[model samples]
Target: MAKVAVLGAGSWGTALSIVLADNQHEVRLWTHRTEQAKKINQTRRNDQYLDAVIPEAITAYSDLKQAIAGVTAVVFVVPTKAIREVARQVDPLISPETTIIHASKGIEPVTLKRVSQMIGEELTAFKEEEIVVLSGPSHAEEVALRQPTTVTVSSVDPDRARLTQDLFINESFRVYTSPDVLGIELGGALKNIIALGAGISDGLGYGDNAKAALMTRGLAEIARLGTSLGANPLSFLGLPGVGDLIVTCTSVHSRNWRAGNLLGKGNKLEDVLEQMGMVVEGVRTVKAAYQFAKEQQVEMPITEGIYQVLFEGKQPKDVVGQLMSRNKRQEMDDLAQLLMERYSQ
Candidate 1:
C-alpha cells in the first residue's frame, strides 16, 4: 500500500482519505484549521465537514511540510477557489517522484483557468505531465459511507493515469483511466453550469423532456469548447463528462442544482448563497465559461442563457423561451466537423 497525503479536510477530502485508509494505505490528512486536524486526530471524526466516523488509520496534521514530507502521492481535495493558495503551501514539501492527483472541479473566476492550470502555475517543479485529475459522478456524502461509486483518473501520461486508476479502484469503487486530461478537466468544470440550468428547469416545474434536452445540448456546447482546446471528443461521453453531469444535474445532493432551483423560485442570489453555507461551483463557473466561450468564439447558447439569468437578471422563463426558439441544425454536425479537423492534424 502507498503512503498518501490528503490535503484538505473538507467532506470530499475526508471521504477520499477514508477510502485510502480502508484500502490499508497510510494516510496523512492535512487541514488548514488546527481544530479540524485535532478533532480528526483525537476523536477520529470530522463533525463539521463530514457527518461520519473517521478511520483510525488516518492521521491528521495542520502543518503542510510534515504532512507531505515522505508520501508517495498527494491528493488535492480543496475548493476550486482555494486551489492555488493550497498548492503554494504544499509546493515546498513535494518531491519530483510524488504523484499529485487533484480532485477539485470548477474554473478560476479571474484567470478562468482550469484547476490543473492553477496547479501548474503554483508548482514550478513539474510539468503538466506530472499531474492527474480524479473526477466522476461520485459524491463525497455517499463515498464516505463506502457506497458503490465509479470515477475517472485522467492524465497526459498513460502510466500515471493507469496508476491512479489502480490506486483508487476497489469493489465498491471503480476507477477508469483516460489520456484526455483536457476533456476530463474541462468536462468536470463545465458540467456544473448545465447542472445549474437543470436546477432552474426543475424550479420552473419543467418536465424530464426539458431537463434531458438541456443536458444533451449542454454537453454538445462543452464538447465544442473542449475540442477547440485540444480535448478528445469521445471523452465528453465518459465518466468525467456525461457521468458527472447526470449526477450533478439530477441528484438532490448537488448544491449547484439546488441553488439554481432557489433562483428559479425567485429568491435573490445573495439570499440563496447565504442559506446554502457551502460553495456552489456552478454560479462561478457560468461566468468563467461564458467569458471563455466568447473569447474563443465557441457557440454555447445554453451556457450563455444561464449566465444571463444568473448575473444579468434575466427571467428564467424568458431564458427558456429564447433557448427553445433558437435555430435548429443537425445533431452531430458540429461534433463531426470538429472531429474530422482534429483527425486531419
Candidate 2:
C-alpha cells in the first residue's frame, strides 16, 4: 500500500487516481483549483471531467506540497504546457526518492521536448533513468468505467519501467513494459497529428478509403521520425504506436480529432478551440513537429498539410489536394531508408 500523488484533476488524472485507489493504494489527487478539490471531496465526484464517482480511498488536494508529502510515486497527468510550472513547484516539495511518472503526451512547441524530457529538465533531483512514461490507446472515459484497456510503460531503467507497470496494472487495466522510451514517447506524441488529419478527412466527408490511406501513411511518417530520433522502428507497430493512432484518429472522444473535425467543417482555429473548451494537443504538436521535421530534414507530408491548414490559413480542401498531387514514390522507400539507417547506427 504505497502512497501516490497524481497531479492534475483532468479526466485522465482522476481515472488513474481511481485505479490506484481500487488497487488499495492511498491516492492524493491534486488540482490547482481549490474549488474543484473541495467539490470532489464533498461529493466524491469530478463532474466536469469524469462521469464516474471517485473512490473513497482517493483524496483531493489543492496544496501541491500537502498532496506530495510522503508519497512514494508522483504521477504527472497535467498538460504539456503546464508540465514545467508544475515540475518547478514539485521540485522543492517532493523527495528525491519519489518515482516520477508522466502520462501527458505532447511535444513542447519551441523546445520540441517530450513530456518526460520536460520533467527531467525541471526536476534535477532525479536521474533520467528514474523517469517513467505511461501511454497507450486507453481513453479516460472508458478507463473510468473499468472497461478493459492496455497501456505501456517505459524508462531508461528496466527496473523503473517494471515498477511503474506494477503500480498501474490490474485485470481491466493491463500494463506492459518496454525499453524503447524514445520510441514509446514519440509514438504517443506524434500519433495525435495523424488523428487530427484523420478527423479532417472525416469532416470533409471523405470515405473509408481516404482515412485508411491517411492512417497507413501517417504511421509511416511517425516511424520515419521516431527512427531518426534513435527509436526502434518496430515500436511504432505496437500499442503506443499503431494502436494509439487508430484510437485517436477514429474515436469521437479525441479532442484533437474533434478540433480537426471542426476545422474541416470550416470553423476557424480560434473558434474551434474556444468551442471545444479543452486542450487539443494535436494543434500544438503539429506546429512543434512541423519545425522539428524541418530541422531533421524528415519527410512528413500529412503533418505538413495539417500544419499549413492550422497555422498558415491554407484551406483544408486545398491541403488535401496538395497532398494527393505530390509526386509518386515507391511505397517502401521510407521503411527501407529507415532500416538502412538503423543498421548503420
Candidate 3:
C-alpha cells in the first residue's frame, strides 16, 4: 500500500484520510495545530470537524516534514486562501516524485487562479501537469459517514489522472478521471457562486421555480466563462459541473449556501461568518469570478447580482427583481455561443 499525506485537518481532509486508511494505505493526517494532532491521536476522533472515528491506519501529525517524509502522494484539502502558504512550506520537504492532489475549490480573488494553478505557482519542484484535482458533489459529512459518493480526478496528464482515480476509488466511493483540468477546476470553483444565489433565493422565501432557473442560467454563465478560458464546454456537463452545482446549491451542508441563506434572512456577512465559524468560499469566489467575468467579457448576471448583494449591500429581493426584469433573450443563445466557440477552435 502507498503512503499518503493529507495536508489539512479540516473535515474534507479527515474524511479523505479515512478513505485512504480504509483502502489499506498508510495515511498521515497533518494539522498545523499541535493540540489538534494530540487530540486526534489520543481520542481517535476529530470532534471539531468530523463526527466519525478515524481509522487505525491513519495517524495525525503536526510536523509538516514528518508527515510528508517518503510519502507517495500529498493531498491538499486546505482552504483556498491557505493553499499557497501550505504549498510553500511543503515545496522544500516533498520529493519530486510525490504526486500532488488538491480538493479545495475556489478561485484566487486577485489572480483568478484555480487551486492547482495557485499550488503550481508556489511549488516550483513539480510540473503543472503532475497536479491533480479531486472534486465533485460529495460532501465531507456524508463521506465521513461512509455514504455512497462519486467524484472526479482531473489533470493535464492522463496517466496522473488515472493514478489518482485508482488511489481513491472503492465500492462506496467511485472516482472518474478527466483530462480537462481547466474545465474541471472552473466548474468546481464557479458552482459555489451559483450555490450562494440558490441559498439566497430560498432564504427570500422563493419557490422551486426560482432556484431551478438560477441553477440553469448559472450553469450557462459557468460554461460561457470556462469555454472562453480554453476549456471544453462538454466538461461543464459532467460531475464537477452540473452534478456539483445541484448538490452545493440545494444542500444545507453547503457553507456557501448557508452563508447566502443568512444574508437573505437579513443577517450581515460579518455576523454570518461569525456564526458559521468556517470559511464561506462562495463569498470570495463571487468576487474573483465577477472580476474575471468582466475581464473576459462574459455575461454572468447571476454572479454579478450575488456580488452586489455580498459586497455592494444590495438587497437580495431587489437583486432577484433585477435578474427577472432584465431584457429578454433566447434561451439557447448561450449554448449556441458555447458550441460555436468550442467547435470553432
Worst 10 residues of 2 by lDDT: 334-343
Candidate 3 has its poorest 10 consecutive residues by lDDT at 334-343
Best first by lDDT, ranked = 2, 3, 1
Candidate 1 residue lDDT tens string, 81-190: 88989888878878888998999899987688888888988987877767999999988889998899999898888878887787788888899888888899999999
- lDDT string for model 3 (1-345, tens) is 999999999989999998888899999999999999999999999988889999999999999999999999999999999999999999999878888999999999989888998899889888777899999999999998889999999998888788888889988899999999999999999999999999889898888999999999999999999988998888898999999999999999999889888888999988999999888888899999999999999999999999999889999999998999999899878856778766898
For 166-192, candidate 2 gives per-residue lDDT tens digits of 889998999999999899999999999
RMSD of each: 1.8, 1.3, 1.2
Count: clashes, candidate 1: 0
Ranking by TM-score: 3, 2, 1
- Lowest summed lDDT across 10 adjacent residues in model 1 is found at 332-341
